[model samples]
Target: MRTKGMQRSIEDFSRALEQGYAAVYRRNFVSVTYEYMGGYIEEITGYAPEELTPEMWDSLVLHVEQKGELSGLSKEECFRMNRSGQVDRWQADMQIRTRSGQTRWVSDMSTVLRDESGDCFGTLGVLQDITERKDAEKKMADLAETLCLRNREIEADLALAREVQHALVSGQLKQFPLDVMNEKVRANFSHRYIPASTLAGDFFEILPLSEHEVGIFFCDVIGHGVRAALLTTFLRGLIEELVPQGDDPGALLGKINRSLKEVFGQSDSLLFATACYLVLDVSTGMIQFSNAGHPAPLCLQPANQVVAKLESPDQTPEPALGIVEGYAYTTQKYCLTAGEALLLYTDGVFEAYDANNEIYGEERLMAFIKQHLDLASELLMDELLHDVRCFSTSEDFEDDVCLLAVVPTAVA
Candidate 1:
């Protein structure tokens, strides 16, 4: 009486579950017969309990198999494994066609029933509808695939942009030798450019203006990546248009400032850049340079074993480009003796932080140059970059780093 009462209670609980059914099968590993079927069976299959025979169930599964929706171990294989005592339970998701000719997904879970002698007799099982869950998973998979393709396309475009920017900057080492004022002079140029990303805000150009004069321009835009890279290109166009004024550093920067101010005024965005331009005349070893809120260039004198910052006589600070509409920039004169070098760089060089969050400031850079005064322009640039990387916590810079070194030697 107690066992019968527990069985009745179990069936009552199973009937309370939605879209689910319970079944008891009697089989001998060759044929299957149902001893009990209840709880939403008709609602799930659209067939009365007596109408759902073994033949009818096989027909519905065959229809799903023809559509290539049935997957995993077949029912026959599961029965074989159970009869041999290799498996006590099995679960799989499968598709079936309802009486209304609509396909639905179901989760079939079964546990083997053992006879008195430990041989398999039948299975106690449950079937649950899972069509909505399967549909949601498919949609998520499709969205992931689409996003992966778009990310690849964006990476390819950024690579192309990096190549173009590298070509524009001419970051490679270059040398120019000339004869001026009855003296033989050699100008050796070397630089290191490291971008924080595929695109950079730092830019430099070496312009050979005359037989005796060479103009060097370096600038740091306000930010990094695509937006900053675009601004560099715009500045390049402006520089080309003003090449005639390159001989006068003050006049050249003043024109570029006005042009940038005019363009920025037409937009709602606030944008500006820091720049320095210098014209080196090998004939007299004189450099006329103008600054627009940029770090002053350093002069390295190997003969005197000294390193000093170059500054104008008045020592007044000028606003960055585009900051003041009618600001008049002025030129500062500095004489470079034989075996002297000039180091021009963006603020990134001195702004890098160490593990303690301390900046690698201008004083440290000047000290390092004074110690390595005997090294050539190319070797010095390489060593400087190595030292800065070593000082950083991650051994990498967070911003774009650009360094340009020019050494003029009077040849015998």
Candidate 2:
């Protein structure tokens, strides 16, 4: 028969078992017998608690056995918990064989127990099936690794494209004859090339249209990236071949439109471009020009402080080159006055916007041109770029800006 106090303790212990606590072992004070072994710890090992005697537990403690045996604990780990009455978070790496022989990884954490007098008793642990968690973590790690590799590959491809653009620009300007322009032509030409993504949408050339008439063209392709770049390249090759025919500005534009329409076909996917072509007569200082849906070039004369737009006839501005087949064009001329400067540019220069979404429009651009009318061309381009950047207040530009300027040596 159990005493009232002993029976109460047993009942309390049994309740603790339901609340995740278990009686691992008991030590008898009277018989000097340390009867260490009890509770649901055997539930984890598939063995009855009484089957593991104190001597058997001791023997299991001395040898490192398989996790499937002896409640899935090694001797050294269990002994440490027994002596210290302090349980460490431990994991048993083992494959559990199910009824169908399926093996999986599982882990559990446990804590040691003690008697009322602080004597080492046994341990109480919580086991959780963690096969799913481990597998998920491994899958996530592999996915992250794959993403890193893809990002590196994308960066490398962009870097190669950037190098190619740099090489294209390295000797491009040097090909132009700067010596023919007057020394008094205080003007500058500076350009920025940024792909809408990985290729430029704008292309400019100052090449010989003929021996007496040198041609200069600035064109903006329909969109951006590899497609736009290829189209611009095609236009460049066409300009090199077609300019030698000595066609006037209007005829040159028509030829280009016909060529593009023929090459790309008149389909909706046909590439389009806005272009301004000028054929300069070095002998008479006359510039034959045409604008194919391009921005009007500005003529700035510091002598009179006059800024004028070379006006075009009020016809509905046609779509850029290559948009429509058989589209006719016309030529205009400007008598180059001594002491006058001309500015040719793409929309990117005046159309840049700020964080507030405000456009640095034509008004601001005219103001800037008037203020720097007397500066050297190169320095002028730099100053304008700096001012535009200040207005934008950011390093990121929405489009590539290009400036080409010409000035006469003598001020009239």
Highest TM-score: give the candidate number: 1
Error of 1 at 21 (Å): 10
Tens digits of per-residue lDDT for model 2 on 1-412? 2368855675566456535533334434333243443355354334465575445434332123234323566556655654565543333443343323344443434444456787655444433334576578879999999999998997787678667666665545432345545422222334545444667777777665544456778788877777877787789889888867634888889999999889888466867899988877654568788889888888888888878876465644655898778988888888777776678777877778888999998889888988888887667777887888899996556776667776544323
lDDT of 1 at 277: 94
lDDT of all the models against the reference? 0.77, 0.65
lDDT of 1 by residue, 1-412 (tens): 1267746764666666543443332333435555455546676678776677656765776322211222355667654575675677756666888999888776666677776788766666666776788678778889988989988988899899999888776743376643435645468787888898889999988877887788888899988998899889989889878877799998899999999988876778778889999998877789999999998889988889998877787677788998989889998898887777899999888788887999988888888888999998878888888888788856667888899988887522
Residue 347, model 2: Cα distance from true site in angstroms:
1.7
Candidate 1 residue 180 C-alpha distance from true site, Å? 14
Name the weakest run of 10 consecutive residues (lDDT summed) in model 1.
62-71
TM-score of every candidate? 0.81, 0.65
Best by lDDT: 1
* Residue 165 lDDT in candidate 1: 85
